[model samples]
Target: MMDMRDIWIVIIALGIGTFAIRFSFLGLMTGRRFPDWTMRLLRYVPVAVMPGLVAPLVVWPAATDGDFDPARIGAALVALLIGAGTRNTLGAIFGGLATLYLLLWLL
Candidate 1:
């Protein structure tokens, strides 16, 4: 179990990290307009970040016996298909959850 001091330390670290990141951005952008190229690139940041973040979790789920799980891959595929088809975030989440649950039940 974590103690109060540990929790305080964690909170302080998170606060400092958040402040530092925000400060850096605000400091850099102060009294200056961003370049068109930078703005255009920022527009695709989400498109790049989302796949980079989700791809790993889908490809490399933890296994029961210390091995990679294939079920996550299938569920992620189903989720991606549903999201692409419907263009809906909730649809993708529900589709993924249902696929994972059904697979878990079957296995």
Candidate 2:
């Protein structure tokens, strides 16, 4: 029961804000090189971000009422092992999913 005009205004404002933030970085950092430390730190961004994004799903999945599931935990561990051993993201994801489904079926 909210006003459509208010929603539109908020959407427009968010769009403008997102564009400005991205433009600020792309416009100003066009040719400059980041420092060595900054570059190294940025290299770990994926490692940090991927886990942060997926940890919640693994730990407290919606279907389980936030209860701990051994199947999920085991599958997560197997996925980590596969990822670490192979250094392949897609392989790890597929392995994790396969393990999860197999475990779910059996347990």
Number of the top candidate by TM-score? 2
In order, the Cα lDDT scores of the candidates are 0.82, 0.90
For candidate 1, the lDDT comes to: 0.82
Clashes of 2: 0
What does the lDDT read for residue 63 in candidate 2? Answer: 81
Q: 13-87, model 1: which lDDT tens digit per residue? A: 999999999899877788999999999988877667767887767666545443566677778889889988997
Model 2 scores worst on lDDT over the 10 consecutive residues at 25-34
- Segments in model 1 whose C-alpha atoms lie over 4 Å from true places: 1-7, 26-36, 63-66
lDDT of 2: 0.90
Model 2 residue 11 distance off true place after TM-score fit, in angstroms: 4.6
Cα lDDT of model 2 by residue, 1-107, tens digit: 77999999999999999999989976788889888999998888888888897799888988899999988898899989999999988998899999999999999
What TM-score would each prediction reach against the true structure? 0.64, 0.76
